[model samples]
Target: MHAIKIRLSQEELEQLENLAGAGYSLEQIAMYLDVPKNDFIAEFYDLDSFVNYHYKRGLLMVDAAAGLALAANAAGGNITAHQQLEKIRMAQFVEREKKRIIYGQETP
Candidate 1:
């Protein structure tokens, strides 16, 4: 995959850490990154790719959390209602993001 350079500051780094520590999924982080949801979905088809991509950028915590979320979404065991709920919420978030892009609310 071709990578475009995106910049982040110290404040964003701290925020990402907090979110990852709280078990936020890749989709959630992607949303926080403010890339249009549709673009994030197309580039990252699943959480695994997201983890690997982010890990290469030094997001250790987020990568590990993405791994857990991907695993839970893959296997049908040991998943709590909260994770399931977050998954659903992220799905809806992606859909809404698509809508925003379609409506031209998303900046390139």
Candidate 2:
């Protein structure tokens, strides 16, 4: 048996993107769109892919704003801002190291 195909209109897609960016879960977005959660999942690639795309987009926006604030604070000699930036840099370095180790790359 062939699976039923569900097509989203352009407006619906835009709405989905907006809702997802607002941190709505897949189930919530599905309900807002008036589509069954299961059907929406089946129609789309998967919940993770759809949710992650929008969530990451939202995070990027937030990160940009935070970065601007941090820059201003650092320029004004805010020690806490400097510390927070260092912590974030260290965490990013650790994550990169982890990825390298997982991929069997020799670490210097």
Q: Point to the candidate with the largest lDDT.
A: 2
Off by over 4 Å in 2: 1-23, 39-51, 103-108
Instruction: Name the lDDT value of residue 34 in candidate 1.
Output: 71
Candidate 1 C-alpha lDDT tens digits along 1-83: 53533444566556655665666665786688775555554544443444334434545565557666766665755566456
Q: What is the C-alpha lDDT of each candidate?
A: 0.58, 0.70
| Regions of candidate 1 where Cα sits further than 4 Å from its true position | 37-108
How many angstroms is residue 72 displaced in model 1 relative to the true structure, after the best TM-score fit? 31
